[model samples]
Target: MAIRVYEEQGIFHLQSKGTSYIMQIVNGYPAHVYWGKQLAFEEQPHSFVDLPEGPLFLLDRLPQEYPQYGTGDFRSPAYQVRLGDGSRITELVYSAYRILKGKPQLEGLPAVYCETENEGETLELELRDAYSGLIVTLSYSVFEDSAAIARSVRIDNQGEQPLQLLRALSASIDMPRSDLDAVYLAGTWNREAHVQRRPLGPGGTTIESRRGASGHLLNPFLALAAPDADEDHGDVFGFSFVYSGNFFISAEVEPFRTTRVGIGINPFDFSWQLAPGEAFQTPEAVLVYSSAGFGEMSRTYHRLYRTRLCRGVHRDRVRPILVNNWEATYFSFTEEKIEDIAKAGAELGIELFVLDDGWFGRREDDHSSLGDWTPNPSKLPGGLTNLAKRVNDLGVQFGLWFEPEMISPDSDLYRSHPDWCLHVEGRRRTEFRWQLILDYSRQDVRDYIYDNLSEIFSTVPISYVKWDMNRNMTEIGSATAGPEQQAEIAHRYMLGLYELLERLTTRFPNILFESCASGGGRFDPGMLYYMPQTWTSDDTDAVERVKIQYGTSFVYPVSAMGAHVSAVPNHQVGRVTSLQMRGDVAMSGNFGYEMDLTRFSDEEKDLAKAQIKRYKEIRSLVQQGDMYRLVSPFAGHEAAWMFVSEDRSEALAYYFKVLAEPNAPQRKLRLKGLDPDKLYKVEESGLVMRGDRLMAIGIGIPAELKDYYSYSVRLKIID
Candidate 1:
């Protein structure tokens, strides 16, 4: 009931109760799983030892020692252990030292290798650092068809004073033979942001340099080929595999303090602090597969991800079309302003009203009042519950925004308990956007946030929560912890945040949560595990979004993206675009609007209403469609993409012409993935065309003579 492990047909299944974890292992997969505190051998040798009622484990025996080379004059002895049946196990050894000059290196330890063999596979666990106080136990259990493996490192704080320890898990893999193509997906503002393969080295691998919105440098390590005889050309890769699976990953180390999780590729290394007697753990899953090409790889990854990962949890029957007040009015809105906008939004058939930032505390801007959960009296006058009630009375679901992990130095929360912020006694604390991060790692802090958030939801008839984390960790240090313990802060911070979110979401299942980290910052699979959707980006301009959404759709589904139509000249770009164009672009995703509805002209209002009506008509198809990139955004001056529903009964195509040649005739576009035998009706003219003819000759459309021009075509399959 707690954790289940099964093996069948050379495959392993690991399931955790009430959690999204469903780990599967395939044939020839070299892994093992163990339960209780005993060593077991079934084809592969493994063992698990329980610690003294704590979160730790130990592997007692290891193989004999072998002399190994190290940097400089240092030579470390390497060793390995053989099981009863004579199978070899690899060993890793470490020793602690205070203030060694330059970079210290450990070498000559036995390396565990996993490769395919005819009958099955073999895994060997070796212990190298016998003198070190910490020992890692590798455990596995063989199932009918497969096996499961877990590696746990055990540390003993037996010294008179509690030891502050820095621990890291390093995995060195042989580089892929061919060009390794990869994609990292994060959910931002209802859309996924992707960083894809560019190029790596003389070999064939490449590392993505782009950082996540939360400043996490993703895919920082890349090796072209495996380590060869040439020492100069060797590849060393290491990454702090932060928590994975569904749910947002967060870390808080007191307000204003910073914590970081780092990924180092070459000269492989991982370093995180653990306080005296404090233990930390981070979970990550690695997937490896070979593909003939990038397209094949992409397709395979998407298939596996959607099938095994995504939770198709669709609730709130209406498919809410919301208007977030931040994009509409920013911090300049009042009760009157919200009422006016809500009235207009209701008339336009918008289903949800989200009161963005500045509705709470003295938050006139992002610089203050992050931790204070109280509603801004000056702005709302009658408290959030009353305002929500009034907004609900106008026939729209109410949503509110909260940046729970942030606090301003000027805020009451920080003023009262500065110790709640992360800081070192002698080290300067870090601040971003004039705000500090809270140390959610503490039990009290977690309880405070949970109670506050729960109170807000319980007090108001709120149906949705916009959870925002605006900045990343900087000036990494924690005040309450010693220097060594500070290193453990980052991983612990993320775990604490995860625990809080899990508790909150479980207690309030009906409340929809939208993860927003300055719009796409922390938009990873981890966040999507909790929030069904995320804000795609802070830049809501239609022209820019065409490219952004196109790039995002490469990995994420449209339903998960929060795309909104804002006024133009767009607030971010300052380019005046037609409202219709904006609405059309936004329609490709979970459609909504951010512009102030009351500010729109009567004609614009009518257009908004019509757009909402059209969205409702196509929402189902858009949400569940099989998207196709008919044309690459990077292929030409114009970017084009299309979406066809799973049933292939309906299709939506979007084309944007950023530039046009002087006299180039209309371009003919070849359609893809269509039902060739079926007839189709174009929504634009209600004109019927044979699917075969449409696919064969394609559609011809004139290019835009100016920049930022777009065209959309809808098709319905006719039997």
Candidate 2:
């Protein structure tokens, strides 16, 4: 059993493969005991600070499993609520708990799941406020195969009167020590998910996104590592929120040197009204502990999320080598031109060809026709059915792009139902990319989108869908919602989006849906539950992607990232990189091309064809293998990573140099995650070496490598 309870001692110990999280009920309050490397079960007195009496109670020093506001604890709390009497003071006492055989799903929310009953165990602790019939249930799930604990909270309004929830976070835990560095991912627009780290200080350190979506500014993830922690050594703790809306992850160091970590909905411009018998379920928060290092932590997340969090037919399948027309033609292309590109992509062995924007309602550019799902007769003569067959006839599957959550002012949907957008009544509606966000918080709006999309999906031969949200929310008010429920718009929008996706993906199980928010804006686990992959970034420059993709791998698997090679003098970044470098970088992920294949020279075409063929041969290995990031792009001018098959039968290593140095010394790249005793043969050089020597002694890198130079070396077991 992953979860063990000591009822006599009022203690609960949850164990994963490599770690244990222990908590105890102290004076009717659930307090955190210890969380670290796995320990043998033993009955012993827990070490705790003696609480001082009266007003100066040492509640702040007590490590709490779910701390609340208005208590003696001065640190950030896990939850806050407003009672009917208009007071925010509330304290919860332990009521009851249950140790279940399997995990329970969060109502109307996405979370990590257990395929079978034996894969995981769940513990639910019920705490209640005696004064007001309010109940808070903190649920924890421990998996048998991964070092991760999934936590969530369910608040039930048992009282007769209504109450407003001022703040509600998913999970919180207090660590005994505070000597660690806070590692977070931060970036904006074209550059997303850059690794940033800083030492933990006495005060609170927070990374959040209040831009409606998870925003490109900050990811819903945070990690605390020992000062000396690196890729291969020391201890690290990672927290990832399984949500897609505005969220905040915070770490606060109290005066006694104890650190409390919390993550969930941002609680900024956010509130929820719970009526009698109503309940609110916060999104799940995943906690991962790594005594081995950040690399092991990443692999734990990769394996768990890849298999448990992501669902549907595509979850275990290799992503198609696609060619998206967004960067190639933008909004300017006709039926004939599109077919030409598809023909060219088919010749280069691309499996899927996507027709991007401008294939809708009088659409010419980004300025118009967003919510219009129908194909534009001007660009696509016979609509999507005709265009899909044209591309499908060229021996390539057809894909499409849709910004369903957005509507342009000139679009027919907006003109017919002007109040369907998210805007304050009588206030100027904010327009981004010449479009306004649809009020998905309403059922009618979701129904309209579902109806339209279902029609198209049923009629066309579409094999893939790129669901894009180009802009974040502004003037986030729903015309149909009451004033008291206005604060629930953002969260409700997310729930509605999830509901829509569930319906669409369930109806069209075969279509591969890739989520995008201008790029990596809405790249989060919540979306990943519905869509298997996401466009990693709009910036496809090979040099830039080195950092973007590397940073993303901290919490996301390579299979969940949609990376593609674009044209030279890259559309997002004007840096010209070699075709080899671009292909090498893109091939490291769900490989694809976003360039004009029809314009490629004969030599370029031949190179692309070879790249496609190579990707086909190694796609499964790359998608399903364990990844080892040898060198970080942020730390030096070179970046390298390797992938080893789970069975230890095959491996691939890639090395990239951004710029050449004059007379640089020879360097050897040490590999990881390989069978040390196995003899492996390098396919490229026809050289054989023992895996132990290859990893310990390493392989030589090109000493004369130039700027933007890269290479991928494949290894297989010797006969």
Candidate 3:
């Protein structure tokens, strides 16, 4: 068994493929012991319960694995409780624990699951607040060949009166002082998920997304690493949440010199009422330990999320080369024009044609008809089916864009059901993108969206759906929920969205779904559970994308990144980069084009055709291989990255020079992640070279390349 428990020693050890996690109970309270490189130390029964004098007498000094409130610990609590009598203190004690043969499913939440009984095992630590009669069960699961420990909590209200839950986090970990530095993914809308590393000093650093999306500003990922650790070496501890709502992940240093990491729902505007016989389950948070450094940690995450966390028909399948019509034509086009673009794309080897917004509900711009789902006859004269058929006739798959969670004030749906939006009495409705967020917390609203989308899916032959949300929540009040439960709206909103997605994806299992929120605002693991890919950024400028993709690669794999080549003097950054550079950077991810094919010159069309043909050659390696960052764009003028196949027989490297310094010396690029003893033949030049020399002595780059220029080389094992 991967999971083992020793009652005599009160120790629980969870052993994954390459890592070990140890926890112990001291006087009915759990404390984290060790989590790092796997150790062979057996658990020998030893007594640590004898109360020591002075500062050690205080519970705060001990490394608690799951600390509670009101126990005089004075530190952050894993779960906070309030009683009917208005007491906010919780005195929790460990009651019992069960080691199960298989993992139990979390109710109303998405979590990683064991595919079979033999794949993994689970453990549940049951704790009780004696005075309040509140039972909290912490669930942990360890897989057979994975290093991720899935952690979550279940709070069952067994008392006579109702209880208020203020801070119910998914997981909290305690660590002894190792002089660790914290690393997290942070950025705003068009520039999301940039890696930021800093010292975990006296004060705490909190990365949260209260924007109701696991917002683009701060993704739900955090890491605590030793100060000397870099990308390829040292120990690193990673924590990531699987929920797509308002979340908080923090790394704080206590006065006692121990660092406590916490992750779960943001309690700022969150409160859940647990009635008698009811239970509340926090979203699952994954904890990974890598004594081999961040790259190994990333590979572990990439493996787990890509294979287990994500689901559906397209999970492991190659993503089609789709060209979205949003940047191509925005809100202006007709059925004939769409067919023309589809024809052009099909002629250029594009596999899918995605008809973006303004194809439905009398919509001309972002101002109107968001919730209406009917096809606009004026734009699509033959309706969706006819257009889809026309596009399919051209040998290209049909895709579409939809913003179902939004309702425009000028829309017919809002005109009929004004109470459907999220607004309180006597307040002017707030609007972003000229639309109001439909209160998904209302079952009727969710049913409306699900039914309408189901109808569209049943009628249209679409192979892809670009699901998008343009803005954050504004009013926060749901008309269907009770007044006392106002704080639950935000979380319920997320659950409702998940419910909708679950229904749609399960119903239409063959269709591929891509999540987008103003080009990556809602990009998080929670969304990845349902949608395999997310639009990496709205900024497609190759120069800006280098940094954007770089920061995102620290956590997300290239398979999850949606990159596209847009019109030059790029739509978002307005910097003109060569077609070669743009295509090279975009090909590092799920490659596609987001520009008009109707306007391209014969030469430009040839370039795009060549780019598409070339990408198809290395698509699998780029999508599924182990990635290595050779040079840091965060600290240098040149950006370089490499990907090696799982078997280490093939590799692809991309080198970009952002700026040309006057009289700059020729750069020698050293490749990584290749088998050192094997010889590789460069496909471009048919030149054979040893991998050791390629990495140690390096390859001489061309000096004729100037700024905004890029080069890519593919290498295969020759002998």
Candidate 4:
């Protein structure tokens, strides 16, 4: 890990392991030169700026790293701001730069940091808009082991007047080559993070979520690779934003065949009030480069997110196998119903019992009792503590659910403070899920919600919490934001939510928190920094989960995929897969159950018991192993995935046939990430196969395994 600035050559070079990021100062401006595999650095490197001939236009002549509009060098701006004088032009020139031993913290943001000076080094460059006195400090931090560079910007108002920021992108990269295809995540509701790869062309192509939450339609991730690149070969560039709010990620190929990548806060309906002496910090973006292909890129991202992004005790700990009551009982469950479920789950070896929504205030459905965190006396007689005690007595951990960010018009909290909800006074409030969003931008509102939840934690023996945000922001206005700063409400609300989460998680360190936004709407690395796992999606069918979990595996570890076994004739897609198939699919992630076990048949119950015992024996392998996507669901009729333990001494593989064919030829399964010389024995059958022959010649799938059938092979190195 190193960061060196050559003043004589006007170059700043950052190296991490085998990757290098080089930038040059051209005419007192930073110009992007190269970012890929490491190259020997000296007075001269392979830089586009070194070209002797170019267009007469200033911007066309130079390859800029982060350009701004109205700065003579005009292509596309990395940042744009409007001053109080009604000027939208921002001409920022490099003012000065400084190097630090380690990363400096971004106040009130969930940013990646260097735990020690030996882990990384930081570089900060100050750019100024002389007219408005706006000082934009671009900060970059490079880590030693992960080869990830974190980038963010701090915009401070040095003038007496206020400045309105029209655009605040986290990081932008200028690549000399434009022949790249973009890889990104795209889906809706039950299907999130479906991979989409398209060729990067001229003009700008953007993927954004203006829904307030990082909507289910698009996840905050993007990758650029040569059109010929595949899973195990070629160069891939990855970019992931660590913010959970509205965001924009764009890849643009210029008329000159140069590509520019940018990511940050969604500029639409976004204008930050940078008052005198105030600074606004954009969320950090992570940059990764992999020459060995998408598989290696995924491993890098998985390692980075698992170790550096997620926090607290659960970061490396084995998560409990929980049974959530959402799919089982939904809104009509009673106290007795919950206790019975818990008792049955304990009998089946379930670790934790999560009492999902509808335990509070008159919340028989989604319409009422959103902000009232107190338990409903009728449904949950004796409140939550008494029920929790009974469940705990049954030898199972207890958990609860809360939607503290929304308020119902019928609830006591909303009636008392109608202004507490986000609304434009004269306009009719738009309701999603029959509730209005709370004005989290207000400190008073955050305090009220946090105190109410904290009171329960202090009294009850709750070991876990499922924090849910049911809907995104609408009627997008905040009463407390006032008229002048109303444009700042969305960003402020995110900050306030972050503060609340930090306080709650810090105060109750023992509680395991799982983030959910109507099921995977708010799934991003930003929330993972606070909560170790997220509800992957609302759809739990084993067949559907193949695609869902498969796409998510690109950036998140298996530890973060909240997979569960729901009822047959599945709730979401209504596809009745075998019980073993569902269990096998769900085991690929943070395993859990979502169906009513009380209704399980004797045979089904025995299968679950055996499955739980098996998981206890092999979850460590699944949770920590390096995953190999053997066959993509999008590519063929079969979906195959495998996990090899870090030491390569153990491996578990799952194969599923989506549809069976008559008299189909036997399929060969070639394993990956194994010691070539080692001999391995299968657990169920004592047959031994050499690692080299298994990968070189391959093995066969069962002939009877057909039509949505699934099979798993657990191998242990025998020699």
**Best model per TM-score:** 2
Best by lDDT: 2
Question: Could you give candidate 3's per-residue lDDT for residues 1-719 as a string of tens digits?
Answer: 37777888788888877888888887778878878777665658455435565656778776777788877777777778888999888777888998887678777677777778888889899988887789988888988877889999988999899999999999988788848988888788777777889888886789887777777788889988888888789999999899888999877788878888889999888899999899998999999888878888888888888878888878888889988888888999999888898999998999999999999999998899999999998998789999999999999999999998999999999999999998986898988889999999989999989999999999999999999888998889987789779999999988888888889999999999999889878878888888999988888889889998988886777899999999987888788889989999999999999988999999999999999998888889999898988888888788999899999999999999988888878788899889999999998888889999888987777775478878888899985
Clashes of 4: 1
For residue 278, model 4's alpha carbon misses the true position, in angstroms, by: 1.5
Candidate 1, which segments miss by more than 4 Å at Cα? 1-176, 179-197, 203-281, 286-319, 687-697, 702-704
C-alpha lDDT of all candidate models, in order: 0.54, 0.91, 0.87, 0.87
Candidate 1, 408-488: lDDT as tens digits: 998998989888876666666677799877886677888989998989888899888889887766544556666545654
lDDT of 4 by residue, 1-719 (tens): 88888866777898876788888877667888778898776665444376443345476557776688775655667888787888788767787889898788888888876678888898888888788888988898888887678999998999889888888899988888889998988999998888899888888879889988888999999989988888888999999989899999998888888888889999888888778999999999999899978888888888878878888988888888989898899998888889888998999999999999889888888888888888888898888899999999999999988888889988999899999998998999998778999999999999998899999999999999998988888887887666877877888889999999999999999999999987889999889989999999999988889998999988888888889999989998889999998999999998999989899999999999998988888888888788888888878777988999989999999998888888788888888888889999988778799999877877788886357788899999985
TM-score of 3: 0.97
Model 4 stretches astray by more than 4 angstroms: 43-48, 51-57
lDDT of 3: 0.87
In order of appearance, the predictions have TM-scores of: 0.71, 0.99, 0.97, 0.97
Which run of 10 residues does model 4 get worst, by summed lDDT? 45-54
Q: Model 2: per-residue lDDT, tens digit, 131-153?
A: 87899999999998999999999
Worst 10 residues of 2 by lDDT: 45-54
